[model samples]
Target: MTEAAAQRAGRDAEAAPSLLYLVKRTEQAVRARLDEVLKPAGVTALQYTALTVLERHDGLTAAQLARDSFVTAQSMADMVRTLEARGHVVRSPNPVNRRELLIALTELGHRLLDDYRRPVRELEHRMTGGLSAPEVDQLRAALDSAWRQLN
Candidate 1:
């Protein structure tokens, strides 16, 4: 290769940020902040996410919850078990499908979510504290587009 081409390649390799690295780093940072914020409530970030999903759409099966929460079915099963033991959620046999178990948030779960709403919202606001509203929207759009690209 020519000297000019070799230099350019080295510069490109050193200067360009990996998209995967950036995404993973951002996720880690967010999760760390969420863990700190949610610790007092005795909920991990994944558990909180699952609870939020259940709050939005009650009566989801464990497998469905796993899909929605981006976790493995086994992890979801364990989480469901924990939630059930804590009385935050209950599972019942699906009437339409006896083989499937439908999971629903109990009244305690609803109340717990209500308690978490403000703190989590504040944490989100803090995460985007530097961004204007428009910038936040743009960031969301860009991230969503990137996510869609993977599919």
Candidate 2:
């Protein structure tokens, strides 16, 4: 290679990946691990996320659940249908807002969440195995701050 091209190549080799790239890769890895852990229970990582949100805050609108689950409204609509069909969630008309329906976890959903809680915790522990607790907290805070800024 020409000297200029060689210098450019060296710089490129020493450069770290962008934060966006690293974050995407980390998300993919987490999703894959969650899928592996949840597959036996017949739930996707996304579905599990929605269920967990409901476990914490019951009777949220579909849009609210979608936002909490980090999915699009349309995607949440379909997910709600599938989850409802599978007896994981149910939708009922909002008592205060008759036109809007609220989604809530079913008994089966609670049971499934309970069943996978330990495995999910183990997955998180494994993912943060090398990081100290403070580092993990820092990572979480950084990510949350980035997300808030982007939003």
TM-score for each predicted model, relative to the true structure:
0.89, 0.88
Q: What is the C-alpha lDDT of each candidate?
A: 0.92, 0.95
Writing each residue's lDDT as its tens digit, candidate 2 over 1-151 gives 9999999998997796988899999999999999999999888999999999999999999999999999999999999999999999999999999999999999999999999999999999999999999999998899899998999
Return the clash pairs for model 2, or none. none
Which candidate ranks first by lDDT, i.e. highest?
2
Off by over 4 Å in 1: 1-14
